[model samples]
Target: MLLEDMLNHQTKIPTEWHTSIRKVGQKFDSAAEVRLALQYYSIAKRFEYDFYHNEQRHIRVYCRFKHTHGCPWMLFASPLRNLSIMSIKNFESTHTCGQHGENAGNLRASRKFIASQIQAVLKVRSDLRAVDIKNDMLSNFSIKINYSKAYESMVHATNTGSRVVIDADDRRFRRLFISYNAYIEGFIARCRPLLFLDGTFIKDRYRGILLSATGENPYQPPHRLIVISDADKGIRATIEEFFPDAFHSRCVLHLVENFKKNMKDFGHKTNVATTLDELLQSAAYKFTISE
Candidate 1:
């Protein structure tokens, strides 16, 4: 009755699909091709390279492809192979230090460490809302880092401070920064986001632009995305103006807590909070407008 059931009925592989898979195998690295072949009996829809292990490996993955049959079949296909002709070796060796040239390996490791440190700090700061990373935190990390240099590097990378002027008018540097910023913005845009707009009073009694976007999860604090703001408006209005197509939801928990504190009668407040909680918790509330 199920698609898998139907697929299981045929023990032999379809000639067309087998031919297609063989063609797909040629596009990947030999290592990945081997993994693909290993999943011959088990249908593969996708694959990923595993790098954290001592030896580089390619993981054969599966996915459910739904169709009009009212049943889903595991598609043993590779989008990476069809769309891009990246050698399986490239995928497997990208994470290894020695696979690239010796100089490249050193640079790669340094850059990787710097990037990892920045991400770690960002994550911690986001969680605490303000992280005062002192000697204790530094010691715990087990790395001999000059915090000042590390901070400076991060600030430069984040574009919050002056960039190292290798060449002031270099088109290549401009292009690289532009591309990097675009990539970071794209990453943030795809995730659950929170946009906040405010003004920070500066010298000479003038206020500066203070627009920031962040990705928030109830399970964790959010990554900050700072951008210059142009106006004073309600958070909702600013969010709507900037990202009209984006999804937004008010913090109902905060709202309920505020309501409880304002109301004098505990019993009545509790009832109201319970009702509000039920209404918001319902799956229907998100898709429908509250009357």
Candidate 2:
């Protein structure tokens, strides 16, 4: 099944691979997209490749054992003329190296891929463990990745929260601060130039901090930032790190809750506590202050 022997045989890819990138002129948004598609195709088919050329202009990958086994598998893609999008130019459907063993798809695992796979789980559970993610990948995707990769993916998913932009490869994940494009646009357009930094301890395996910055929401008109959480030292520190200029305010709701709890602890009657709470709330916002 060597490249030299490929001419004498009628070997070609089977039709069952729904994720195949073999079609010429297949378009993609960027080089990262093309690479990601190739990774998906390889993972789906249980194959591996080495990047022969990976540049801003083009990407060319061949079978990992191309030299040793003379595998004919290869794919090449580049940007179309005067366009930013990439398109597949040439592809060899035959892979002499053949299907790899269990967890072969792990070789193609990237932070972006892992992030995508775990996004659904993250929607339901924030304390998802790296071992659980690793095991899930092995069970669901037939990919056996390192615990570090799983941890990094978990961190990236939690920080980015519904946003993911894969940069380069797994080893060189572009470090970033979190901001959605829509949020940035809203802040630049209708919102004031202020941020409300806050944090809550994640009930996670690592028991880490969940730092956040909030401004006027997308649906709202011009408004000020509001930090809504129980006042914790973590929020003060986080604001110092991410938004040093913005003032941190304790949430009034949390303060009210604490007041009620303290009243109960002091053996105050329920009716008395309720009357005091109502008084505080009505007097709390008599004058207009930025919430």
> Which candidate wins on TM-score?
2
Q: Return the TM-score for candidate 1, rounded to 2 decimals.
A: 0.24
Q: Return the clash pairs for model 1, or none.
A: 29-88, 44-76
Q: After superposition, how far is residue 54 of candidate 1 from its true place, in Å?
A: 46
Q: Write the per-residue lDDT of candidate 1 for residues 221-290, one digit (tens) a residue.
A: 2644332233334755866787666554544444445555545355566677667556655633466565
RMSD of each: 22.0, 8.9
lDDT, candidates in the order shown:
0.37, 0.71
Candidate 1: where is the Cα deviation over 4 Å? 1-150, 154-213, 216-249, 262-272, 280-286, 289-291
lDDT of 2: 0.71
Model 1 residue 219 distance off true place after TM-score fit, in angstroms:
21
